[model samples]
Target chain A: MRTGTGAGMPQRGAVGAEERIRAAAVRLWSERGFHGVGIRELAEEAGLSSATLYHYMGTKEDLLADVMSRGLRRLVLAAERVTQQRAGAGPRMNALVQLHVLTHALRPRETRVVDGELRALSGDRRGGVMSLRDEYERYWRATIDEGRASGAFRVEAPGMARLALLEMCTGVARWYDPGGPMALSEVALGHAQLASRVLGAEELELVDEVDWCRGLVGEIWSGPGGG
Target chain B: MRTGTGAGMPQRGAVGAEERIRAAAVRLWSERGFHGVGIRELAEEAGLSSATLYHYMGTKEDLLADVMSRGLRRLVLAAERVTQQRAGAGPRMNALVQLHVLTHALRPRETRVVDGELRALSGDRRGGVMSLRDEYERYWRATIDEGRASGAFRVEAPGMARLALLEMCTGVARWYDPGGPMALSEVALGHAQLASRVLGAEELELVDEVDWCRGLVGEIWSGPGGG
Candidate 1:
């Protein structure tokens, strides 16, 4: 996952210098938070000079905004793709869960960056990212509402229900360890069950139950595989 | 509520300097996070000098710890009082909701500071505060578990049920307004209904509803009448 080159660079086994810089920035920001980190330290950590760091990404605030915007854009795109692929409210909701879980599994740093640093983005930048977030929230809101209206979901207050579901999902990033216990697929399915139950899913077939159990068992047995 | 004056103070109507400092710290911390605000600015905001600020509160970190510890201690005390005042899981849970809602409504800045700045504390200070918080969470967790065990609540997982309930109560701090259309009592009642329902409470009597609503209404309607 860390082997890819930067946007303009040719493909190689090692990430291009620009990509390396961005990756380093993500790591530092996640650990120290947005305001606590400095550009000089980030540059040194990335094994680059301050001038070279600017060549890759602009100011510290610009890097923060870019990190958040890029991550949110990917999430929105994934959600959009899921919405496109799945047909009904139930499947679409499931797809949404899968996309969220997969994205968190693959890019936990990016997810944390977006979640923790939105306040650091000021004015139009903050508003713009927040609008994107609202759109993503709408996906869940619409699914919950549509499911309720269609008699598929039994929960009251679609808005509150959406909040509950999203919080549960977003919380995954806080505790999820890709190398620990359950595979991403398994974790997603378990979360899907939790979400579906909250949304009033009536029953789980043996196969679904088996799949969920297998995932849990795999997670417990593996004892934290490679992230 | 702001009329407290320490002994030897000349002004009778003025709030004590210590209380004033805590209030200012809460406001500043909530607006700008723990690491973002400076003691000098906090002093100025509180209409005092840095020297005076030191007289009341030792250091910036000390102020942060004091603010968080005081708020958390109040919540713990409130929950303890509520538990002692009410019998049975149902009543106790109602009391818990009232305490939580009231604490959040009356002291939103403090609540925000505690919730948002826990990660910034270290060693004994952080551990002490966290232990208190955990104990507070346990009160709700125990109520939910008891309710479920006695067939009073119908949630599958007591921990998740507790989290859901706490999230709803804590969310009041995010959107609550004194001049909103619904009185605090009305909003608290609505939240109580939502919390009780999530906890599998069946009855919806007006008294229980009002008991649930007391904190929010008390916070708003009793603004001039009380704190």
Candidate 2:
């Protein structure tokens, strides 16, 4: 999972200030990477004094973990919602791919932070992020397994298929542009179709619904519960 | 084409010493990223004095361009070889996917530098890398187009499918471990099958010869032209 469906946010208290700091951290960290940026520069980017930054975000590594975990939490929540839908495995997988694509396209910076900075964290911090990542992927694994069990898919390698689909969906963050010719909804739908074909369920018809996934992304990344 | 099959290498002389330096550059750059590493540190890691580093590898950015171009050149060569085979679109595509999987799985660090550090290059250097990458993917685009023309594929979105498949194959670098239980050849064959299915060609026979691809990778990466 290159874009492992997570980033960060302020925990509680001083909510506005913390969110501002986090937003800046995601932007800089994604741009320069976790080890490349300095604390002072992060503070400057967030318009906070260095002393104030330490108080608000703690150490840089802590801030990184927070950003990655928060981003991942949103992804996990979206996956859970899709899995719990009344739709069966095929539609559920469609929604899952669409949701992952939309989130990555709309929130590339945060996703990059989550995808590229795992090495910067130490033991417990890394473990926590990995745990969250595992939970998010579990939704994907279960969905694929269900589809396979029902003979809805013909994938020869389920584990490889899950990873391939994830990387395919996440690549949107690297290449998709809001200002580009492709519409966001179109990108999501196209990816869903590609995913269905990859999973050998093109005959089953992907329960294509970009509008639903779009709404979910809007709620997660920009919604009150998101950041 | 985020992992568009390229990195860097030495342009002028210093043959053996230069290859060693570039090898170390790939390791350090892939591990710590371009910005996170310094010339002095690169020199130390390469077992060369700072002065000798410049003599062998030129500037750091120049070194990066060389590494990327060299890597891309190898991929382009492999892609060319596959495309030239008498096999039709299905086999060519399978071989391309298998070759990609093998290269990324066997040479994860080099591929990571190729995939992750595009922003590290500048101006003409970036353009040089991009041109090489474009040339490499032209093979893939051509193969997909050929499949569609022959009624061998059912892909609805050709451009998106190419990107999706490339990202999916490139993902072998991110998750594959040589120490893992899955055999290397199994990974390659599974990806080829997944690719064939994704391109809507599951009913068509994929020219699944990972052994052939394995041989090509050996010749390309360790061949006389590669180093």
Candidate 3:
């Protein structure tokens, strides 16, 4: 999805300048990464004076902490929502995969900023963000474990499997180009299929199997559609 | 796997100033990421003057480029060596997995800098590094295609399978710590198992499956032992 458009638009509405600054920080942090950007440059990018930025987010590190904490909080919230909607591990995992793929594809910048800029935050901030990340990881781990236990999934190590699945999803932010071949929905679906394979889901029976197989063949022949 | 120590001990052969600078750069880059560390700070961290630092590496960006390029070159070289040694696609893929796992476990910092700092390099430097990376990807892609054609690997899409497998291995650099539970060899082995699974080779009763499985389990339990 294009930035500055859609429902996920940064709150630049009549909101306070502080909110605008935070939104700008998220955008820049995602694009250039925390270490690559400076406070003055970030302020300029946001169309605000460095003094105003200071007044809004306090310090450069503080801006980073705020951006990361807020983004991670959103991720945690999204995971919680998915967990609440789906009862079983398989459905919940599918929901998690969908949520992860959609969020990353839609908010590529924000997700990148949060995932790549963790070390820039101070110790306390880093700890808080990491705790949230661990919690998010736990959800995935539990889902994989449940799938394995229930014979819905066959994986060697649930922990490692979860990590691999998360890595595949997180990498979407790195290479996903909205203008590229595949649509966001398509990428999410492809990722769900790959996740299913990673979890060792049984082959779909007859009717579903042929359709799924055809979809994959179509995807392969399509040749690197939009991320 | 500790920094400043390699397999051989060349007695009385002290590290050159340039080597020391590169070493310092690796440490800083790994800790704070490429764009996070300033030249002056890096010099201070290396216990060298800023002027002296320039004599060793032309610019901060040059330092990053050199580090990334060298690391990627090493990775590519290693992968090539493995491929050359193994005759066919199956054994070649196995070697590639083992080599990749060992490299990640042995040279975690270099792996981190190469994977995380790709954005820091500019123009030709960035293109050069990316080309090398693409070349490395080609090795895996070719192997996957061969396996699929030969009926050794049972994957619906070869390209996506390559990407997924690469993502899984690259993730080792992020969370692997040397001293954790398993040894480096163990972690590499575990990754080999994961790689085999990703390639859809488990269904094939290939030779050396037992060894590959052992390596996979070991790498998993090792958790990137804290080098």
Model-by-model DockQ, in order: 0.23, 0.61, 0.40
Interface DockQ of candidate 2: 0.61
Note each model's CA RMSD in angstroms: 6.5, 6.2, 7.9
Model 1: CAPRI class: incorrect
lDDT tens per residue, model 1, A11-30: 44324555566678788777
Clashes of 3: 22
Query: In terms of TM-score, which candidate is stronger, 1 or 2?
Result: 2
Deviation from native of the Cα of residue A31 in model 3, angstroms: 3.3
For TM-score, the strongest prediction is 2
DockQ, prediction 3: 0.40
Q: Give lDDT tens digits, candidate 2, residues A97-205.
A: 8899988988899899887788889899999999999999999999899999999987878887888889888889888878988888888988888888778787767
Which regions of candidate 3 deviate over 4 angstroms? Answer: A1-15, A47-52, A181-183, A204-227, B1-15, B46-48, B181-186, B204-227
Which residue pairs come into collision in candidate 1? A179-A224, A179-A225, A181-A219, A182-A219, B184-B216, B184-B217, B185-B217
